[model samples]
Target: MHYSLPLALALGLLLVACQSAPSDTSTSAEAMADATPGAAYQLVWSDEFDGEHLDTTKWNYNVGGHGWGNNELQFYTDARPENARLAGGTLRITAIHEPWEGKEFTSARLTTKGKADWTYGRFEIRAKLPSGVGTWPAIWLLYTDKEYGNQGWPDNGEIDIMEEVGYDPDVIHSTIHDKAFNHSIGTQVGDTLRIPTARSAFHVYRTDWTPDSIISYIDDQRYFAFGNTGEGWEEWPFDHDHHLLLNVAVGGNWGGQQGVDTTAFPTAMEVDYVRVYQQK
Candidate 1:
């Protein structure tokens, strides 16, 4: 199904909200050597996304249009090797403007569902985004429970570790959604970080989620923090466990403004690694 232009644009922004910079001074290898060590924490789980294929043992695809909570256009398919792949030390999810299974857009959504879940910890991802007027790439987390005890949606809570819009290349957003506030209506407490060359170089997006607070960081620089208020679920829905999700979507409510740049077909959001750590 083709999504309406307005809806596609809105979905593009919202999907990414639940969520850069490159310097030519050094090579990737050189930068790696000079990289500041991340704060030491016990490693709990990680996927380097190495090898030639996605490790099915760790991730599951969301598959087909489940509405994706945002009227997204793509069909999310599982076990479709075309949707998810590991190559050259990175996991690549490409969004294409094409017809697939009754849908106009075909893309992949991968998550560490049953394989892993965490309540409080530091989660990090090193990624390079895909660029184009209609590309939407995101790295975020969601609660594992089927429902937040009937509270539903934002009440159940959602954490967007990193979300970037193709049109806004320099900004990366991090946000939390709860019953009292949601992104759909523009009621969310979040922050944006600026990256000069996010689409060209890899940068780390991270979140330190604790019992008392949720802190978002970009390459270790903390930009946003939300604390648990006494207001219960209405204010804070993050006391429970959540799993990770990574995907690249094209031409949704938010992504199709300039229309699909068919020339940029097969664009990819490349992830170098995804790691989770717990306090010792």
Candidate 2:
């Protein structure tokens, strides 16, 4: 959810070992409904990637190459099977080093903007990351509607459930940005956890959001939490609706800080599933 590069970073230093969490591999709604018994949160929305094609009713394509306010190098394509597709019960978002629309790379960005937006819930995603310098893969959330301030970006809010730069392999990041706490001013609230097998194996990345706070977890261990300070909206605009987004970029300001490795062409972030749960 880093739309623009920051002059400095206040990254969290609480790193921890990656632990394993029990995973529910079920793709049926009936199964998920019964999986979390006596739990505070209940399954409400999900996409298991169990279909042979991307479910249009559940996902929408975001197409563009305008750097997405981050000086990114990939041109996001719409409905392009080469960039985004479903296969073997998983969703593959590929970033290819190819010429397209005057850009050197092409990829796909899928969002659940109008389809699914939530105020407070537990957002969980299970996926294996892509590596090699120049790649930037992310599973994050953005404000669904511009209702707070004039500038939709920092004025609204953003939640980065998981983000990893190829150059810094295995380091997963979770961040939240608002008018008062944004990277532009080097006050963003965020954290990073090193998961050794993040690029080789599937791991669960999650964010539990409530009216009072927003917390992030890896596998099932908590690493970061930002509590609501009775402060103004500039500090916590997450009280409104936000939607999910998934994509892999070729390179850009942060992702291309060390420069892109052309040899790493055709890399992909493979997602097993995305599930959302709200308190019952």
Stretch of 10 with least lDDT, candidate 2 = 16-25
What shift in Å separates residue 122 of candidate 2 from its native position after superposition? 0.5
lDDT of 2 at 50: 93
lDDT for predicted candidate 1 compared with the true structure: 0.72
All candidates' TM-scores?
0.82, 0.88
For model 1, residues 126-230, the per-residue Cα lDDT tens digits are 999988777778898888864565555666778889887676665787777776555455445566788998889999999887766677888887777666654
Name the TM-score of candidate 2: 0.88
Residue-pair clashes, model 1: 19
- Give lDDT per model, in order: 0.72, 0.81
Sum up the clashes in candidate 2.
0
